[model samples]
Target: MAEENRYTFTVRQATEADWPGVIDALTSAFEHDPVMNNVMGGDGKSQKVRDLFGFQIRHTYGPKGTIDVAVTEEGKILGAALWISPEGQKGGLIDEIRALPEYAKVLGAGLLRAAIVDLKLLAARPKFPHWLLYTIGVHEDARGHSIGSHLLDFRRFQLGELPAYLEASTYRSAKLYAQHGFVELFRFKSGKPVLGMLHPAPVTQVSKNNPAGR
Candidate 1:
């Protein structure tokens, strides 16, 4: 017999009311992420980390991207995923200018480095249209569960023909992404190494009704 599953949760698109939970989960999730620390120092729980998540979640990705959350039956948020839909892939220059003040607040003197990191990632990304997984994080308390996998699959299946792309910050994450059909395109060094991968659009038809393939 297969091992019994202990945790139960569902992944869904995040809404305005879920921003706090989303930020908390992501802050905890990326608390120690190498790429995250490289861009914004301090483990993942600092005010800068919180502020960085707040700015990205509410102002940047939230408006022009898709945000997904994993929640238990009682409605406690376990993890969150931030994404930039292909439609909004190339973020507007206006958006970047508008984001300067907020980025300054979170990054301070390091804002220039953070901007450089963003430019580097942008320049490294594939030229074709694809969904960008900006970041996905799980609350520390919920680490052992398969919440991250669920969050990734939720959007991956619903994406129709669009491929998905993300920079895997660690070897473990890169392997995990590979398990889900993501293949590394290249690796680049910033503060930490980043492995850029792509999950090409599936060859078979992905049902509209059964989006998650459940």
Candidate 2:
């Protein structure tokens, strides 16, 4: 049993060398998540899931995006968060097509087809110039230690006035986002409901504090 007070970890930008560990953590964390299982079309630990996440990490970890990891003092990766800046929101049909070969290889043609359709449906939502919280996962053993909240808080602090966005695939996740100040924008119904949400920019709070518009 990992106790929150007894455990301590640091959250930092993940490096390429951290990819394997990050993937492993995410796989373990989301293995039973409804949306992840639906998207990857398998038990989340399948090679398909790993390949899908690897593809996303590769594309989302440069100047336009980042992967942040929470690691123990001894450098054990315990959780990860994937975020994409406004400039990285170029995930249109072309990007989906480009990802097809890899997904097809891992997931097979049928699952790949269905997954692409789901992706397209999700992508149909209106987008704004806001930071996107693509995914966050904490190791099962580390669940009660507030690693997820800490990662979210770290991003919120760094983002300051910028807005953030995500789609919550389960009501439980929606509640988690709500606790973090995200408001539901809309819900899309596939086999299950997905709540799209936005954490509006902190500009109002900034103005409230400064009053002089500084």
Candidate 3:
């Protein structure tokens, strides 16, 4: 746990019971995200936006991955990070589609089109075995307190010898990931310039430093 002013921040694996808070936090965090605005197609505060993110959170929670949340000592959720291991990546598309039926009913053909565009953008990226940092969101009210940094550091510690990957939706976020040792691999020319980043394992860095170990 860490402290900043009146808040004591702690990171933990989110449980099913945390779903409501998680959805709300993420929705608030991504409310102004360019890519999300493009896909959601509105002021980004509509019921469709909330339902879309709710569906995503529900589907992405499982044994093969984890959704970690940053909370205050008072139990207020301030942020969330979703990570999918290499094995979890295999059927992620199918799982996401299966989770989208209800949302699709509400969002209609626009949702399907958006999903395809998102998949195509993802497919254009390099494929390799790495932990996927699917999403990281900090509540708007909690932005300047470094809650996002704490969440990223928690995952970095857990990752250890494994590489981690993510597609950042904003340049500001891409810069934050860069500060945590991720290097930009590519950038997509969509509604927003989505930047892909890869964080190589700490072990890889150590091995490079000690040639004998290699």
The candidate maximizing lDDT is 1
Better of 1 and 3 by TM-score: 3
**TM-score for candidate 2, residues paired by index:** 0.85
- Please give the distance, in angstroms, between residue 106's alpha carbon in candidate 3 and its true position after superposition: 4.6
Candidate 1 lDDT over 24-56, as tens digits, reads: 887777778887777775564467888888887
lDDT of 3 by residue, 117-204 (tens): 6787668655777888878998888888888999999888888678998888889999999999999888776636478888988676
TM-score winner between 1 and 2, please give it: 1
What TM-score do all the candidates reach, one by one?
A: 0.88, 0.85, 0.89
Q: Candidate 1: RMSD over Cα atoms?
A: 4.8
Clashes of each: 1, 0, 0
Off by over 4 Å in 2: 1-3, 113-124, 191-193, 204-214
lDDT of 2 by residue, 36-94 (tens): 66655555445666676777777555445888899888778899999988777776457
Judged by TM-score, which candidate is best?
A: 3
lDDT for model 1 comes to 0.81
Residue 164 in candidate 2, Cα distance off native in Å: 0.9
In order of TM-score, best first, we have 3, 1, 2
